[model samples]
Target: MLTSDTDAYYSPGHVAQVVAQTVERSRLKSVIDSHCGRGALLDAVEKSFPKIHCAGIDLDGNAISHLRKIRPHWTLVRGDSLAWTAWERIHRKLGGSVDVAVLNPPFSMGQVKGVNIELEGRVLRGSLAMAHVITTIYHSNPTRVVAVLPESTMFSEMDRQGRAELERLYDVEVVAQFKSSTFRGARANSLLVGMTRRKRQRAASSVEKAHYMSLHNAIVRGGLPCFEAVSLRHGVPFVHSTDIKDLVRGEAKESLRTVRPFTRGIVNGHMILLPRVGVPNKANIGAWFTEDDVQLSDCVIALQYRSERIAHAAAVNLRRDYEALASLYRGTGARYVTVGRLSEWLTNARNTRTYAQL
Candidate 1:
């Protein structure tokens, strides 16, 4: 059976070769593959740089034992790379010089097992792969770091905090984005990101300042939570995904309701709303607000734009490329779009055209 190693796909020989190629350009003496799986990466590094110090860490005992038997010279330790003890064992051996760090971490594992990250005094529910990247950079302080991560890590609103922290700490850029075909049986896309740690903090990506970056707060869950308690006829106007035929071109036609939310209060000023939970459709995928406020339902997503013009530009952009949004919906059933997917799309869209075009 062609299957991934639970939440992650083990790097194939060819994939390992690509990683080796990336590492070859850098002048480094020691290398570490935090999630080394079957050791394809370390093997490739050793082959390319014969005398380079190599260390591999994995949580799989069988894989580690097998690699140790085959390559007795390597320091293959079986432990979770996210934990400090694993590095301690490696430190006892390699003297803790992590010049180059390469990884293919478990993807989306946090969705099932859950991941809570506390960074700069804010709590984030990001992915496992994201956590791996952040912790690796912090602990190893590697001059060069390369890893395979999902696109959402860089573009998703849910992961914005982690990405900001990483970009804040390193000079990050995408080295390569691999199609699904790159991995034998892997269904999702992945990217090979190369990052160099910065001694001083630098400015973040423009996408970080773009209008869509703030959409994370607007992607609400199904229950509606604190907002659902208010009556539809008493507080603020309520809008559902099915209420509108298509997204409003600029500002929505007035339709008021009385729903009030205790948890998040009310949203006033220019707001752009999208369908948060539904089978993606060009028609039902968009909406917005100006001046007046409404209590958005579970099906709708809300993004507050700094001004009416930016909100109008956003609406125009959505209408122009709404078809692309339809393709982003993912799930076995009841497919839906995420703030990350939309934000990623916005970032790419912004890149393709000039600011004035929007």
Candidate 2:
């Protein structure tokens, strides 16, 4: 039967559990609970480690008063967290860097009207201001930060830039997350993020590892065979996947013109017949032309694939590897087709067939 005026309040047991978990995982000699609502978090930390120093700060005087009455041993301050100078002053008074900061800051997303305000002679949004203060502390003191953030902030695509900034400045990791209807009588999801000050090189390695593991898991769960069957040739002039459909349908008016056998190349998953030289001025007029009209260059290469398998006993040699196929046709002035483009061609071809049947 605990009640509070805070936007989001957790049960004492839940807060104690989270604080205990954070204490166990982080090297927290001293803890600062920003937006400390009722001092439940402070009580939990002190209860777990009596020797560990703890402080609580809140903008609400009533909350701070209540905290002081309940836990007179804990230091309670009334101040806005977004005040950089005040925050720095408090940090200085603490004598040294804090080991950990645990916060359940106000979820001011919809409740607070964001205003463009001047801070240190720079204009910044209120929401961004709060983030800036947190980032400043993170940069100044390599403290471990564990905070509960709105689920929207964690998952919204629009916050990609903000998320990237946070990740760059901190060894940001989501330790645990869950959905609960704990805020304003509405079901709001939240994430508990754990962060530590990371060196530039170490942070890069961490980001790479996260990306690699995510990609590996996705590939495994997708149940798709490894794309080891495909090979890529950089800097190939790509035609849009849709353009392949027009070419295959003979819908390309240029293909209608009878041009000299200028050169043969593979295009859009099929063989292409182009003049040895291209037609000039006829560029606007989509038609094939004679070699004299165009210049032959290595720009275009023929992409060839085995229409049928060749047996070893036959004069035709069998090539199984993509690299081997690329090497064999390299001197022949042929290029390789990407599997993605090939798939697009196949899809369009099927669509064309379906249309014809209809």
Candidate 3:
């Protein structure tokens, strides 16, 4: 029974179970909830680790008061987590960072000005509640962090920059996706993420690759550009997965044209053009080695490659490892492969090539 605006949704029992399991595995000594509504999460944590120290923070005084009466021994504070001052005081009172942090912060967008939380290499920037909670948890410098967030947070437009920052700084150990129906009264799906704090660096050997990075680091740049479609009279050469198949079979170039002032420039043949959504089939995996450049539609993405050898190797590896690549799709709609998913596959290719070279 967390109280927020109409957009707010409380944690479901399954999400709590996931968080509790993460806490147990990490063997955390202390836990804190940044947006503990009605203390449902704290209750779950206390049940698992009976003697572990706990604290709760919420914007609703009544919610805080109600929880305090039942668990007076725990420190429950009422404050806006988006503000740095509140966390500063909380840190001083706790005397140090908590061992684990479980948060289900509000989901909303607004400018959070004048607050800078340092991560391993960069600062997360956004006006979203999710961004604030993530930065706040990072500021606390906790050893482990588990949060339940909307599925869109996986690769949504609004949280792209912040998500990139988090990926760069932390090791995302788990991303368990569940349908929105999992929540008693919600309509949008969500993800339970398990992240642990560590210094950012590449693996020293192949054995440590999974620990240091996922397949995502291999994607240099990707996005489905948006632009008005026009007739061939104003068109330039355009490419689709079908056109790529024709090229592969030694067929003449299909006449395709796009409007002038295209959103994305024609990508070189060295880079791979993949349908942003598909069944992970050979025809769907578009690897181009064209003499001239061509523009791509919003339905596809240009996976920029740094080396020609790397690009060629990725195409071959993707064909053989299509099953593994299929597992990277994010949403349930049309089997769309997000930038994060594509990057994961590319990273695998790069790592394999690097190891082969050695």
> Residue 9's C-alpha lDDT in candidate 3?
65
Estimate the overall C-alpha local distance difference test score of candidate 1: 0.65
Which of candidates 2 and 3 is the stronger one according to TM-score? 3
What is the per-residue lDDT of model 2 for residues 76-136, given as tens digits with 9 covering 90 to 100? 6777655655466557656546776776666545544343334344553344324533544
List where candidate 3 sits over 4 angstroms from the true fold. 1-7, 25-27, 108-123, 126-130, 156-164, 167-169, 199-284, 288-297, 301-358
Candidate 3 on 1-358: residue-level lDDT in tens? Answer: 2223523467777678777877644355678888887877777888888877788777788888988898888877888766666677678778668877887777543333323444567674443555655766665767777877765455343454455555544666545666657666666556678877667543335323342223222332223244454545555566654555565455554455554435343454455666666654675453455556566666666654445565566667667767776777657567777665554344344544632221
How well does candidate 1 match the true structure, expressed as C-alpha RMSD? 6.1
Q: Pick the candidate with the highest lDDT.
A: 1
The TM-scores of all predictions, comma-separated, are 0.70, 0.49, 0.62
Which stretch of 10 consecutive residues in model 3 shows the poorest summed lDDT? 211-220
In candidate 1, what are the lDDT values of residues 57-121, reduced to their tens digit? 88878888988899888787898777888888988987756888888877855225337764445
User: How do the candidates rank by lDDT, highest first?
Assistant: 1, 3, 2
Query: Could you tell which candidate, 1 or 3, scores higher by TM-score?
Result: 1
